[model samples]
Target chain A: MLITFGAIAIFFAVIIVVLQLSGIKDRDFTDYAVGGRSFGARYQAMSFLNTWYPGAMFTAFGGMAASAGVISFYVLSYSLLTVVLMYLMAKPVWIWGKTFNLRTQPDLLALRFGSRHIRTIAAVVGIISGVPWLVLGMQALGTLFQHMSLGTLSFAEAVMLGVAVIALRQVWTVRMGMRGVVISDMAQGIVAYIIGSAVLIGLIVWMVLARGISFDALDQKMFAIPSVGSAEGPLYLFSLILTGAIGGWCWPYIFVRLFTADGVESLKKSAALAVPLSLIFGVALLIFGMLGSQVPGVSAHPNDVWFIVSKEAGGLWLLGLAGVIVLAASMGHTDGNIQATGAQIANDLVGNYWQLGERQLIVIAKLGMLALTILSSWLACLELPALFSLAVLAYQGIIQLAVPQFLGIFWKRGNKYGAIAGMVVGFVVAVVLELGYPGYLPWAYGLTSGAVALVVNLTIYVAMAYLIPQSQAERRRVEELFDLIEGKRSAAAVSKGVREPA
Target chain B: MSDDGKTNPNNHAAWIIGWFILDAVVALAPPIYWAFDRNRTAILGLPAVVTYFVAVAVFITASIVAAYLAEARSGKAG
Candidate 1:
């Protein structure tokens, strides 16, 4: 127990000390919000990974594999597709972000549609959906702490301690802003994904060869996937993969990764580099979970499979390392959410309403981070069942942003009316269907509520584009934005070149 | 290729769109995955379904690398 706690403590201490030494002071709001838009492929890749897969990857996702079966591999498929989307969107998003000094995802929408109302709507939706996950992230730490204590601490005591540790980590988040978050993501990602993958692979080898826990010995049902004749229907796996691929970037913390890269090329490089890491780590963890189900106590408490197997295999030392990995991943997740949400609050919500100075915006953003940290920590302590359900539904709701975000970038025809209407209706429908059918709609043939709502959302967006045509001026403005993407010479530049020849 | 003797951006875009289509079919298409859903075979001590998806991921990664290289050759990466 002491060794496990000591390992976790050392992990936290190293992260904080490194953050302190690397912290930059006197950064303006832009510098604070997006790390001054200066990071290479490796930093950007790690930051994206840390934000993409929370600590729940170990607990909730691992549990799903242990309990359900191979369906958890949906993460691996969607993650790769998500990276492809990131690569495709890199040029347009990075160019616009750098060109117009866009800081948040909402800022990009507002710039594209020329509407502050759209910005506020996007920002509000982002914050509302993001808060639940932040609370759940804090709760994930509770599980980590409980396991690390080796039965010394009660679940309630562990919950409080986990929340407290995460809340305290917000000090650096609020102080150093995105810079601190990115730097810490590098360290945390290494522990969580790199070392964590190694541990998972090692344990798998030990379990299969030494302990005789091969697939042949396990139940055949663990390998089955839902297919055409299955009860869940054929589209079930398809919907899961599609939702994850499209909705992956809709999370504000994940979308903001676009702004952190140095340029479009760097962002593309990062997307390429992120693929293998996500595949290896995600696959190894799920495989471990699936194999660990054969262990004595794991099937009963599936969520504890990662820790249970670690403790069973190598006893205390490996368990300590596992604890440290989850702790690092969770801390990175919590910090990223806090920083991104804070910047959205200050930049999108408040800054749009009032013209605040840079320093004032920075202060407001920091204050927002502090307030959110406290609120989420308090909510995490409640451990409400309804909140976890909402966090799951939040994924469905967040994907509503995709239509507006992608269309606004690619298709100039999508006006603010369409963007706003589609998102509002899509989010409401997702929530309603999710509440009615918690996970999937049986009536919809295994299609998720999110997918059904997305269909409606896309219909409305396309219809409105033709129904309510943009004014000539707005059309030209949008044309100019697209022109920037194509590298077309502007009228002014063309005239200047001709005149210079004389 | 365009008349300027450079790779046409539209062709590059087409290739990318094609790659994405391939990826979607391989990763999400029910029929494609259903073919491998049987548990009769195991490649690396993993079920056929699991190995199929793992291979799909690698294929997708290679496609992305191809796209990156194409973009670099066309000088459109930046």
Candidate 2:
């Protein structure tokens, strides 16, 4: 345990040094929000992966898969589809961000609708839907810390310890903003994904060969993929996938990635790269959990299967290594949440309304991160349910942004009224249905509450869009925006055609 | 190719439509399997469902790469 904790300390020290050396001169709020939109393919790809594959994927979701069986694999499909969505959106989002110097998701909404109220409402929704997941993510660290301490620390003590460590890490996040976050993400991603994935593969191979557990040798539930007619059937799976794919980028941390890539082309390449890596890690870790079901006591405490199996197979050293990897991944996600939500609070909700300058905004953003850290840590100290459960609710609420964000980007007919209305209706419906009827919608067996809310949300959005047409000025502005997009496309095309053939 | 040798707006729209069609079909297939399959088959020692997942993952990955390359090619062309 000592050696493992020491290694983690050193790893964090190295990351801090690298961030400090990056000399993140975030002169303006734009630089703080998006690293001046200067990251290349590798940095962008890894950063995206690190943020997307949160620690709970290993602990909570993996445990769920271990216990609940094949239905959990829906994440794999939705995740990849989300990447495809990213590829399609990359060009327009990048063009807009670059053109307007937009720093956050609400900034894009404001640009598209030309309304401060839309931006404010979007910012409010972003924070409300985003904070729970952020708190839940911080709470996941309690599990990691407890496992690493080998029962020496109680769960509460472990949670506090995890909170302290994260607070310490936030110092760098506060200092450097997005530049620090992106650079540190690269290092942490390699550790969590590359090194951690290698450990998972090793364990799976060990399970199959050494333990001689055939893939089909598992429980019958493990083999069956539930139908929509069944309990975990179509509606359930569909809801999971639908919410996941549509809402994937709606998370402020993920949506903000649209502004981080150096170019549309770079963004496209990053999507291409990120999908495979996400699949590799997600599928591999889930498999490890599935195989882990064979080990005694794992099916009972499925969340601990990773550590349990690791300790069984390779003893204390490997378990410690696995702990560190999970820690790195979890912290990577937590830091992103803090930085992004903090920036949103400072820039969109406050700065937009208060008319703050860049310097003041940066200060507020850093302070926002600090305040967020303390609040979420306090939340973590209170024992919450597994992060996955909270995350599902978060997904339900955040996906409401899809009607406003995704549609507003692609369809010019969508007005701020529709965007704001759709988001409120969708979010309220989701929360009500989720709280009232937990899994499936009332009367609609198998349909997830999230999916139900989305259907209502989209219907309202479309109805409102057609009912409330954009004003002549709004229509003209939208046309101008699309023209800018076309201009970029034409420029790229002309450059290609006119250049001498090599 | 269309009546015009150059890629027309219709063709571009068709490509996008085709991409979505493929995406939906691919994404929906696994769930359909989950809805119906009784786990009778195994591919390379893993359950058929898992095999289907690997296959779709590969297909989607190839499609993404191809799409990017095509975009890159289009950028290079007029």
Candidate 3:
């Protein structure tokens, strides 16, 4: 217990020291919001993977794989597809961001559509969707706290410890802002994915060689995909992948990273680099969960498989390392979430209404982060529904941004009214269906409520775009913006002074 | 086509369309696992479905890297 707790304490201390010593000087809202659009391939890639793959990837997704067999491979599909989406979206978004000095995702919407109302709507909707996940993330840390405690602390005490760690992590986040978040994400991502991969690999080797449980002995169905005729069915998986691929980048934290890259080409390189790392980390966790299913006590509570396996393999010390891995990942994501959500509130929502100076905006953003931490911590203490379920519900709302954000880039006919209306109607449909049907919608016969809502949302977006025409000025402005994006994308690489790889 | 009607390899439309095709292939291909997911088949000591997923991952990675390189090349040329 001492070894575990001591290691965690050291880990926390190291992160703080590194963050303080990094020399992140935020001169204005630009630097505070996006690191001045200067991150290279490594920082952007690692920071993105860090924020994208939260600790829940290990706990919830891993647990799902262990309990549900091959059905869990949906994550693998969605993850890879999301990267492809990233590669496609990154270049255009980067150009626009540079051209307009855009910071938040809502800022992009407002710029693209030429409407502050769209920005306000995007901000409000983004915060509403994001708050639930923030609350859920704090609760997830409760699980990490319990595991690290090794039965020494009561559940309530563990929850408190979890909240305290998150609040403590926010200190650097508040000071450093986006620059701090991305740099720390790179550092913490290394600890979480690279070190975590090594530990899982060791655990797997032990499971196979020492325990004598071969893949052949595992459940036959574990290797099989669920059919459309099965209880869970094809649409369930399809909806998840659709939501994941499209909505994955729509998350305010993830989308804003597009602006942080140094150049358009750097964005592409980041996507290429992020793929294998995300794949290795994702597959390793899935394999860990699958192998853990063979262990005795772990199969019963799949969520605790990583901890149980660690303890069995190398005692409390290993379990302590495992707990640190999960904490690193969870904090990496939670901090980015707080920073992005807070930035959106201050820069887009509040700044639009009131003209605040750079220092005032920074102060407001810090206060927002502080307020969010307290609220999320308070909610984490309360009895709430499952963390994973709440997260998926948030994704349903986030994905609604796809049509207006993604398609609006390619198609200039979309107006602010359509963008705002699509998001509002999509969110309402997702909420109504989620509340009425919970997870899967019987009304759609095995299709996820999210998928059904998305269909309605897209239909509304397309219809509104055609029916509600953009004004002549708005149309002309959009065309000029699109031409600029295209021009920048194809312009000579000499401007960046970096030769393209042959 | 350009105003001269010559084929343009560096055309943004071609790249975008090609990317979309690749995206559709990857995003829609996973459902094919349903047809060959049975555990009776094993490949290189791993389940056949697992092997299939590995193949798809490799394919997606190669395609994206190729696209990225091509874009980089085109951007540099202009």
Candidate 4:
């Protein structure tokens, strides 16, 4: 059952790729890159589904539930808070991006603080945190479709193959930019949701009509290991839940979406729908975890639950559906990470190096994204590190940025001296804590660096704010930046603003 | 300068921070003490099991407030 489904899934994936390559007309690097940054609310809604229903949610997170206890649910709880996180994040990031006329993550940081130091710090952190998750995804992809009796691809081979496929997908990405990725992400997202719902409904029917097991029984089986179902720690569980909502609050890729929105209203519209969309669609993966518990014979790895169920129910058809969902998850995350990384590199490094034109830099940006895709995919194939911990490590790294930048924006005294020193120190501290602690490294086992970094960061900020002499020009630069963000701009101000090429 | 224009979600973000410290004390002290010191005072001799529920409640409460404040701030349009 698993083998047949996998074959069918491969065929469907090939077809989807061929159609995307041939059928899409406006397939330029830019369009392919950020979906030309013209995504409407409806398409945006679809993109939300693709973004939320990721492999970790479907595949690995279940495994966490199996091993880690009820806290497995905590991974998901963070998702609910996204409603508030997105709303808080969207407009400010949107206004900043539109005003700066930015395209990438590094660009956002560099432009905001007007500091190469900030950009460099951001890029290094992006790569460190991002590389591991890509590897973890590759690991899951390797493990996916294990129903193949031939075992033509061992786990290593599968990881390699998956990474290769991701790299190939980016060929299209390299030429397209956010335009291509977001469009496909939206398409994949909507299709995954619709098809995922159908597939799940189909499975539920089989369980009810064919197997004679009730939903209540299945729920019992899932909850039978109550301790396994719940997460550990008092505050850590809450922290995990909160992290779901706000941890990714300032994620660079998500911020990019804000820039592309039609206006603040689109931002509002997207935010309104993003939460429930994530919670519902993401929960679809949980059904696989639930089913995995019921089938007593299946002793395969816990992550294999989704694949096994897909094969068991409808064989090839369900396998194809599940495959597509995983692909969409990997692609959506990869695209965002790559684009944000590319944007940072292009704006901070490449543009600075060559002082290139918009046409040239945008082209370079696409290539840079391609580079990042390959690098991340290769890392994914290695899969030595654990997933969620790595994600926490990365989250901690990015959230580190939130401290300095947040202070710089909101507080009058948040000067460059404090911003730079605080960011640097916070980053070093995070790295040391991550490295020194064993479980803490790739996953957040010991303590959340968000608190430490924020605390250490604020302490330095307050001290430096008192010590550093406030410069008039620097003050003007920041005030003017905020004013432009608040839309108090003249025609001259608008023209002189956002150095996006003549 | 007067704090009227744009507020940081840090107001509630701070509360999340507070809960994190409480969790560290409740959840980690035993293991931390076990690893470093054989001293019972390090765990503070507190029951580990109940801490999980207490911490979970605190985290959930803090998250709700954070989410509420973040959304409310966004609605204000900077």
- Please give the DockQ score of every candidate, comma-separated: 0.35, 0.25, 0.26, 0.05
Candidate 2 lDDT at B76 equals 21
Query: Which is the leading candidate under DockQ?
Result: 1
Best by TM-score: 1
lDDT string, candidate 4, A20-47, tens digits: 6645544443343345557766667666
- lDDT digits (tens) for residues A62-110 of candidate 1: 9988888788888889988999889878877877787677899998888
Better of 1 and 4 by DockQ: 1
Q: Tens-digit lDDT track for model 3 on A1-502?
A: 7888888898888888888899888999989889888898889888988898888877888888788766677787778888877776765677667766788998888877777787887888788778888887787778788888888788778888898889888988988999999888888899999999888888888999999876676787777665557666655666766777777777898899988888766777888788887777777777778878999987788988888899899998898898889888998899999999889879987898898999888898888888888888888888776665676677777788888998787787877777878888888898778878877775464677767877887788889889988767666667666656555333332123111111
Candidate 1's C-alpha runs over 4 A off are A490-502, B1-13
Residue A288, model 3, lDDT: 76
True contacts kept of each: 0.42, 0.23, 0.28, 0.00
Judged by DockQ cut-offs, is candidate 1 incorrect, acceptable, medium or high?
acceptable
lDDT (Cα, 0-100) at A218 in candidate 2 = 73
lDDT of 2 at A165: 87
lDDT, residue A150, candidate 2? 84
Say which prediction, candidate 1 or candidate 3, comes out ahead on TM-score. Answer: 1
Clash list (residue pairs), candidate 3: none
The TM-score values for the models, in the order shown, are 0.95, 0.92, 0.92, 0.75
